[model samples]
Target: MYDPKIFKTYDIRGIYPDQLDEDVAYKVGRAVVEFLKADTLILGRDMRLSGEKLSGALAQGIVDGGADVIDIGMVSTPLVYFAIADYGHEGGIMVSASHNPPKYNGFKICRERAIPISGETGLLEIKHLVEKGKFEKKPSGQLIRTDVLDDYVNKILSLIDKKRWKDAKRLKIVADFGNGMGAKTLSNIFNTLGVKMLAIYSEPDGSFPNHEPNPLKEENLKTLKKLVLKEKADFGVALDGDADRVGFVDEKGETVTGDIITALLSKEILKDNPGAKIIYDLRSSWATAEEIQKAGGIPIEYKVGHALIKEKMRKEGAVFAGELSMHFYFRDFYGVENSDLAILKIAELVLAEKKPLSELGRPIKRYFHAEEINFEIEDKEGKIKEIEEKYGALQNAKVSHLDGLKVEFSDWWFSLRASNTEPLLRLTLEAKTKELMEEKKKEMISLIQG
Candidate 1:
């Protein structure tokens, strides 16, 4: 049975065998080929236990739908995007439920040049096709087993010249791969550079025996933080299930939010591409824009979601973009999330400054953030309108409905958005002072909870 719930705003994800078995994968594959009208497509998967069988079924359907499949097996989601954009495949699919538990699995679809096919783009039609359970049969296509790992790694290394070393050896890092796809490229890059790194759970295991592959949760990063302090490493990084997202831990065991990374990278990226536009999600701290402006780069506040950010970057010709969820997009990588490249960029910044990661990130922490708060409300938009009717009337408030409701003042700001993937309302507030942030956050909560 095709569980319509699996078709999400971003991708198709659900519990394996139950909600998203081989049958669903097969049907989705057929729908993708039929919809894209593609002659050839690239395919890749993560280290999920169910990936092997599911990929086999998906390839069968793609072949049945008259599109040849270039199966780049057991690679990161970034690698799949690279194969599609850099190699010029018509479209592609990555079979991996990013950051989800072991029992869950899914697929991320993309078009030519790695453009994502979100619910707004074409996922809903694909869902309907799967539900209809019908496809016009054509000549069965061939499946070619290919490995693009070497090329992907070379692309990552090209950004950071290995010949120069360039003080890179002076930096030491503690990385937690969480037994996901990150271990593949990180291992190759560090080995080629001969950088000292304390790698934890580097092995590619579908079970994710060490911890859940989500770095956003503070608990998942506890071991990484501990190792960084114990090893006296300059910094630490944790890669999520598919290695497309990442989280950073500084030298002092402080968690560096994604926005702060954007601010830090702004300084480094702007040095080369002066006046380049950099996009950050609206949830980011004000210091993100401040740092970008200071570095002579244009800072653009955009709504969240990887697909939307990628499109916004392409349209604005942004050199870099970062989301609060730790997804970093780079123009060099065709405006897609590349956690490996993000890591290398951070390393380069630290090496160039000859300072600790904390020192490099300190200036970016200039404002007070209430952190993201989530409320489970049945009527999310109704509550948002209620809050808007109240705050929008303020004489000094500037309201924007870009991704959600954002009311801003000279001293404070807040963004309330309904999550695209889950049934929840997310609130992000910041202010010039910590006290002000707390006060505003509390006030916002009352409105949302009511």
Candidate 2:
């Protein structure tokens, strides 16, 4: 039996054995085969404890449904995406709970060319098919094992110019994988690039011995921050469970927010592809858009989510897209999110600038931002409307309900949205001054919760 709650806006995710088990995995396997009408598929899993069992059961179901499987064992999520496109498979599935606790596990599924299956785009249908469970029986298809590690590394490495390699070698970097699957590919990339790297929690451990794999949380980034300072490294990098999302700590051991990194990288990319369109989620800091425009690139704000961002990237012919949640997508990468590419782009930028990461980001860190805060509110929609009505009357204020209620003023903006997973209302506010941000935050909180 599968829990309906696991069918999220973008992927399938839930606690293992209880909410998600081999039975559910098998059903999802069959559902994907039928829903995508796939003849062949690529499959991979992270270092979670239940990965083997889940992938085994899922593969059995897929093969039983008469679709061949190219099993690329024990890889990061992006590697699975790479395998699907690189090998010309019809679709793929990755068994990873992505930044969740070790006891939890789930799958990220995609059709040909790494197109995601989400709630509005086939995830619900797959869920319905699984619930129905009346699958057609057919002769099992082949399950072949393949290795994509070297090819994946080489392909990403090719994106970097050889001249930058020498400068990269001069840099001392530190990486904290949080005992996830990042070390598998990252170690290879570092070695091949001849860069000096201090790897922390580099070993793949499903138990997450050091800390949680999530780097977005300040607590999770503490270790990386310390190591970067202690080693005096050029910068520090952190990746989530499947290594698709990345986080950074500057040489000063300061944790950089996702949008700041976006602004920095936008400057680098825009230098090469001038006037290119870049996508930033509405929740991101105004610095992202300001930096993009200053760098001669067109900035477009889109609703958040990997599926939506990728769709916008393709539609606008955007060179890149960055979200406050740490997801970065690239047009060159078949419109897929790739933390590895973000790393390389940072490396190139560092080489070109010849400045410390912290110094490089100072200009873009002009604005004060309130970290995303959530309030447990029963009337989510009504509260959002109330705040909208109160603020919408302000002169020169712009309101957008794209993904939530966002009000923009000359010096500040705030977004209020209902959480998709819980009975909570989320708020994020930013301003030109810390005092303004504090004042508005207090006002917003009182209005939202009171």
lDDT of 2 by residue, 154-267 (tens): 888876677766766788889989888888788898888888989989888999988999988899888788888888899999999999999988899998889998998899
Error in Å for residue 44 of model 2: 0.7
lDDT of 1 by residue, 1-450 (tens): 456799899999999888989999999999999999999999999999999999999999999999999999999999999999989899999999988889999999999999999989999999999999889979999999999988988898888645446666777899999999998889888888877888999998989898999988999999999999999999999999899999999999999999999888778889889999999999999899999999999999999899899889999999999988999999998889899989988988887777899988887788898879999999988999999999899999999999989999999999999999999999999999989988888888887886
- Candidate 1 ranges with C-alpha deviation above 4 Å: 161-164
Candidate topping lDDT: 1
lDDT of 2: 0.90
All candidates' TM-scores?
0.98, 0.98
Tell me how far the alpha carbon of residue 313 in candidate 2 is from the true structure, in angstroms, after superposition.
0.9
